[model samples]
Target: MTVPRAMKSTMFTLDGRRGVMLACMAPAAAFFFAFWLLPTARLITVPAEKGWSAYFEILTDSRYLESILNTVLLSLVVTIATLVIGAATGIYLARRSFRGRQTLLALLTLPLAFPGVIVGFFVILLGGRQGLVADFTHSLGLSRVTFAYGLTGLFLAYLYFSLPRAVASYTAAAEAIDVQLEEAARMLGASRWHITRDVWIPQLAPTTVACGAIVFATAMGAFGTAFTLASKVEVLPITIYNEFTNYANFATAAALSIALGLITGAVLFAARLLCGLSPAR
Candidate 1:
C-alpha cells in the first residue's frame, strides 16, 4: 500500500514541531540540571556526611530549635497581621476613589522599592534610641521606649515589606470581584457587614491565603534585615550565617538551610494547592 500524501505531510509536520520544541527546551533543561538540581543535591547530601542524626538535632538542640520556632512564629504573626491590615486597606482603596488616593497608595507601596536592609534601618529610625519615637517621648519627660533591637523591631521590618506585597495582591483581587453580587445583597436589605461576610469574604479567602503564604515564606528566609539586627535577634537565617561564617560549621549550616527551605517550600506548595482550588480558578 502507498502512503497517502496528506499522511506523509502530517507526519512531517509533527516531527518538525517536536524537533522545534525539544530544541527550545534544551537550554532550560541544561540550566536546571547545572544550577538547581546539582546545588539541591549537594545541599541535601552534605549534611549526611555528619550522619542523619545531625538533621534530627535541629529539633533537639535548644539553640537551633529556638531559632526555628522564632522564625516560624514571627513569619506566622507577620503574615496574619499583614493580611488583616492589608485586606481592609486594599478593599477600601479598590472600592473608593478620593482626593489624594493615588498619593496614599504610592506611599503605602513605597516600601516595595526598599531592600530588606533599608527596611531594618527604617524600623530603627522609628523605634531606635535617638529615633523619632524615642526623641518625642524623651522630650515629654517620659521614659524612652525603644524596641529597635528586639523581636518587635524585626517584626515591624518584616511587616514593612510584607504589607506592601499583601496590599498589592489584595487590591488586585478586590478589583476583580464583581460589584453586582455586592449590590444584589444590598438590595435584599443586607447590611454592609452582612454583605462583606456573606459575599466578599468567601470570594477573597483563597487570594488572601495565597498572599499570606508569600508573606510567610519571605519572612521565613529574610536574611538582610535579620543580619542587620542580629545582635538582638536569633532567627534561623542568622543562625545559619553564624554557623557557616562564625563557627565554620558547614554541615550544620547546610542542614539548617535545608530545614528552612523545606518549611518554606511546604507552605508555598500548600498555597499553590489552595490557589488551584479557588473559586476564581
Candidate 2:
C-alpha cells in the first residue's frame, strides 16, 4: 500500500507537535514531582513506619473517630444547605431580570473572595461575645449571646464559604438549560410544580451532585475557619493539625490525613460515576 507523500509529512509534523507539547509540559511535570508528588508519596508511606498498625490505632482512638464523624456531618450539612438554597437562588436569578440583578449577583459571589479565616472572623463579628448579637441582646436587656467558638459558628462559616461555589455552579447550569423544554411542559398543561419536579430537577441533577460533592469535599478538609473559630472545634483537619503540630505525632497525623482524603475522594468518585463519568474523565 502506497502512503501519500502529504500524509507522511503530516504524520511527521504531528510527531514534532507532540514532542513540542511534551517539552512544554516537562517543567510543569518536574515541578509537580518535586513539590507535590514526592511529598505525597512520603506522606502516604508514613503509616508503614509505625509497623502498619498505625491506621488501626488511629481509627480506634475515640477522639479521632469523633473528629471524623463531626467533620463528615458538618460537611454533609453544609453541602445540603448550599445545594438547596443555592439551587433556588440560582434558578431564580437565571430566570428573572430586574434592577440591581447584577448587584445581587456580585454580592452573592462576593463570598468567594473571602478566605475561610476571614469568614470565621465575619462569623465572630456576628455572633461573638462582644459582637453584634451580644450587643443587640444587651440593648434589649437580655442575656449576652455568643456562638462564635462553637460548632454552630463552624457550620455557619462553612456554609457561607461553600454557598458561593454552589450558587455559581447552579446558576451556570440553570442558565445553560434550554427554556423550550419548560415551554413545552407548560403547553402540555404541566403546572409549575410539575414543571419543576419533572423538568427542572432532572435537568439540574448533575450540577447538584457535582457541586454538592465539591462542597462536601471542601468542608471535609477545611481547616482555616475551624482553626480560627476555636482550638476546641472538633473536626478531622484540626485533629490532624494538632497531632502533627502540637504532639509531633507524624504517624497518627498521616493516618488521619489518609482517612480524610479517602472519604473525600470516595465521595467525589461516587459522584462522578453517578453522573455517568469514568474515572479517566
Candidate 3:
C-alpha cells in the first residue's frame, strides 16, 4: 500500500508528539515511582510471615484505634474552620476594591511564607503561656488559660498554616466568578439572602471542597506544628514518628505509615469524587 506523503508526515508528527509528551512526563513519573511508590510498596508488601496480621493488629488495638479517631477528628475540624475563615476572607477580598486591600492580602499571606517550624514557634510564643492569649486570660483573673501541647493548641496551629492556603485556593475560585451574576439575581428581585444561598454558595461549593481537602492534607502530614503544640497528642503523624524514632520499630512505623497513607488517600479520593460530582456551573 502506497501512502500519501502528507498522511505519512501526519503520522510521523503524531508519533513525535507522543514521544515528546512521554519525555516531558518521564521525570515526574520516575520520581513518583521511585520515591512514593517504592516506599509505599515497602511499607505494604513486606515480611509475608507477619502478613496482614500487622495491619489487623494496629487497626484492632485500642491505642492505635484511638489515634486514628483523634487524627480524623482534628483533620476534619481544622479543615472546616479553615474553609469558613478562608472562604469569608476570599469572598470579601474578591467582592471589594479598596485602599490597603493589597497590604491586607499580603499580610494574610505572610504565614504561607513562614516555615512550619517558625510558624509553630510563633504560635507557641503567641498563644502559649506568657503569650498574648495567656496574658489576656491572666489579666481577666481567669486561672491560667493554657493552649499548649493539646488538641486545642494543635487546632490553632493548624489554622495558622491552613488559613493562608485556603484563602489562596478560594480566592482564585472567587475571582474566576463574575459579580454580574449577583447583580443579575438582584435585578430578578432576588434578595441578598436568596442570592447568597442560591448563587454564591453553589458556585463556591467545589472550590470550598478543594480548600478543605488541602487543609485536611496539611493537617494530616504536619509534624513541626503538631510536635510543638501537641506532642502528647497521639495523632497518626506523631504516632508514626514515635514508632520510628522513639520506639525504633520500623515495621510498626511502616505499618502506621501505610495505614495513615491509606486513610488520607481514601478521604482525598472521596473529596475529589465529590468535587467531580458537583453540577457544572
Candidate 4:
C-alpha cells in the first residue's frame, strides 16, 4: 500500500510544488504590499492630481533641499569612515592569526546587536554636557564642550553602527582572498605597505565599495539614532518622520519618502552595476 517513489518525487518537483509555498508566498507578498507598496501607491496617486506640483513644491523648498543635502553629506561621511576603519580592521583580523581574534570580532560587532537608541544613549552619556567630556573639561577649567544633539553626536552614533557592518562585510570578503597571492607579493620584495596598496586593495575595492554604499543608505534612512540625538539635524528621514507624526502631513511624508526611495534605488543600482563589472571568472 506504499506510495510509488516516482510519484513521491514528482509530488516534490518544482513545477508540481504544493499549495504550501504558494500559501506562504501569498501572505508574504500581501505583507509587502500592505506595508510597503500600498502606502507608496497612495503617496504617488494622492499628490499628483495637479501633475507633480507637490513634488515640485517639495523639491523647491529650502528646508527640503537642506535636509536632502544634510542626509547625503552625513551618509557619505559615515560611509567613508566605515570603509576605512572597517576595511583596515577586517584586513588585520583576516590576515593575522591572533589570540583574541574571536573576542575582538564580537566586541567590534557589539553595537550592531544593541538598538540604535541604546547607541545614542551611550554617546550622550559619554559625550554630552555633564557627561564624561563635560566633567573632564570642567576638571581642567576648560570650556564644557557639548557633544549631544548635533552633527558630532549623530556622526558618532552612525560610525558606531556602520563600523560593525563594514567590519563584518569586509572581513568576509577579505577571508575569500587567497593568501598565496599576498605571500607571493611579499616574496617578490614588495614592502608591507606596497603589498597592501597594490595587491590587497585592488582585490578588495569592489567589496569595499558595495559595503560602503549599504552603510551610506543605512545612515541616510536612520531615524532612531538621529531623532534621539539631533532633532534640529534636518536629515531627510527626520523630516519625513516629522511630517507623518508631528504635522500629520501624510502627503508631504509620502512625497519625501518617494524621493528618498528613488535616491536609494539609484545608489543601490549603481553599486550593483559596479559589482557586475568586476571579473567573475
Candidate 5:
C-alpha cells in the first residue's frame, strides 16, 4: 500500500500540526491540574472523611451560623454601597474634565495601594477608643466614641478597599458607553433621571453585576481586615481561620473553605446569568 508523495506529505503535516497543538496546550493543562483540580478534589473529599455531618456543622453550629449571617450581611451592604458610590463617581469622572481630575482620580484609587490589614489600622486610627474620633467627641463634651472593633469599623475598612476596584471598573465601563444613546434619549424628551434610568443604568448593568460580585466576594473572604478589627465581630473567613489554625480541624476547615467558595461562586454565577452573560464567564 504505497501512498503518493503528496498524500504522505499531507498526512505527515497534519500529524505534526496536531502534535504542536497538544504541546502548546501542555503547560495550561499541567497548571490547572496542579493548582485547581488537585486542591478542589482535596477540599471536596476531606470533609467526607469525617462523614456528611461535617457539612451539617456549618448550618447546625451557632458560631458558624452567626459568622455566615454576618459575612453575607456585610458583603451585601458593602456591594450595594460600592456600586452606588462607584457608579456615580465613575460616571462623573468619565464624563467631565476639570482641573486636577487626574489627581482626584489618583487619590480615589490611593486606598488600593494599602492591604486589608493596613486599611483596618487606618480605620482604628480614625475610630478607635483612643483615636481622633474619640478625642474629638471627648473635646465636644460627649461620651468617648469607639467603633474600631465593631461592625462599623469592619464596614468602613471593607468599603475602603472595595471602593477603588469598583470605581476603576465602573469608570472604564462608563467610558465605554455610547454617548449617542444619551443624546437620542434627550432628543426624545427624556429627563436627566429618565436618561440615567433608561440609558446609563441599562448599559452599566453588566458592570454593576460584575463589580457587585467582586465586592461581595472580597468582603466575604477578607481575612486581614477582619482579624485586625474583630474583637467581637465574626465573619466566615475568621471562622475558617479558627478551624484551621486554632482548633487544628483540617476537615472542618476544608468544609468551610469549600462552603465559602461555593457561596461566592454561586453569587458570581447568578449575577452573570442575570446580566445575560454566559454562566462560564
Candidate 6:
C-alpha cells in the first residue's frame, strides 16, 4: 500500500532536517577531533610511556611544585586585580555618557589587540633598567628601581592584557542590569553603599566570577610574556617549554602540561558551577 501524501511529506521533511543538522555539525566534530581530542589524548598518554609514576612526580619535584604554585598564585592575583579595576571602570563607562567616553573606552580596550610578547615589551618599556620608572627615579636623585624581569613585571603584564577582557565582560553585564532596581532602592532610602552592596554586586557576581576565571586561565597558560621577560621567572609554561626544548624531556613537559591543564580546568569548572548558582541568574 502507498503511504498517505501528508505522511510521506512529513517523513521527507524530517529526513531533510536531520541531514541539515548533521551537515552543520560536521565541521565542528571534525575540528574538535583534530585539534582538541587528538592533542589532549597525546598529552595525557605521552608521559605514561615513562610509567604512571611520572604523573605523581610533578607533586614530588620541588621545581615542578614551585612552578605550579607560582603560576597559580600569579594568576589568582592578576584575576583579582583585573576584576576590581575593570569592574569599576566598566561600570562607570556603562552607566555614564560624557565627552571622550567613546575615546576612553577605545583606549581602554586597545591593549586587547596586543599579544603577550608585546605586553611583555610594554612592561619593559615601563619598568626596565633604562625605562620610564628608572629615568624618573634617577632624575629625582633616588634609587632607580627596575622590576621588568621579576614577578612584579609578570603580574603587571598579565594585568595589562587581562583588564580589557574584564572590562568588556563587565560592560556587557552591567548594561544588562535593570536601572530601575537601583532607582527603586534609592527611593526606599537605601544608602549608595547599601544599594550597591545589596543590588549591584549581587547582580554582577556571576559575570565577575566568569571574567576572573578567563583571566586566571590566560595567565596560567601565558608563555610569551614569561619567555620575553626573564628565564628565571619559573612560571609553569616556561618550565614546560624548558623541559621540552632545553632538556628534550618530553615526558616531564607533557606531565606538567597536563597538570597545568587540570588545575586551570578545575578552577574554571568551579567558577562555572558558582555562576550557575548565582542569584543574578
Who wins the lDDT comparison? 6
Worst 10 residues of 3 by lDDT: 40-49
- Show where candidate 4 strays beyond 4 Å: 1-15, 18-20, 191-194
Instruction: Give the 10-residue window scoring lowest on summed lDDT in candidate 6.
Output: 224-233
What TM-score, computed on C-alpha atoms, does each candidate reach? 0.93, 0.93, 0.89, 0.89, 0.90, 0.94
Q: Write the per-residue lDDT of candidate 5 for residues 80-136, one digit (tens) a residue.
A: 998889988998999999999989999999999898999999999999988899999
lDDT (Cα) of model 1: 0.91
Report, for every candidate in turn, its global Cα lDDT versus the true structure: 0.91, 0.90, 0.84, 0.86, 0.91, 0.92
Between candidates 2 and 4, which one is better according to lDDT? Answer: 2
Q: Candidate 3, residues 44-160: lDDT per residue as tens digits? A: 766234777777878899988988888889999999899899999998888789999889888898898877787778877877777888888889998766666688888888888
RMSD of 3: 2.4
Clashes of 3: 0
lDDT at 197, model 6? 99
lDDT of 6 by residue, 1-281 (tens): 99999999999999999999999999999999999999999998999998977788888999899889999999999999999999999999999989998898889999999989999999999999899999999999999989999899999999998999988889888999999999999999999999999999999999888998999999999988999886556899999999999999999999999999999999999999999888735
For candidate 3, the TM-score is 0.89
Clashing pairs in 1: none
Model 1: weakest 10-residue lDDT segment is: 272-281
**Stretches of candidate 3 exceeding 4 Å from the true structure:** 47-49, 133-144
Pairs that collide, model 4: none
Better of 3 and 5 by lDDT: 5
TM-score of 4: 0.89
For residues 1-281, write the lDDT of model 4, one tens digit per residue. 99999988887795556676897799899999999888778778866765677688789999988899888898889899889999989988987897989999999988888888888898889888778998999899999978877888999999998899889888888999988888999889999899988778878978877997799889988888988888546888889998899998777777888888888888899999988887762
Better of 3 and 6 by lDDT: 6
Cα displacement (angstroms), candidate 3, residue 156, comes to 0.7
Q: What value does the lDDT take at residue 174 in candidate 3?
A: 87
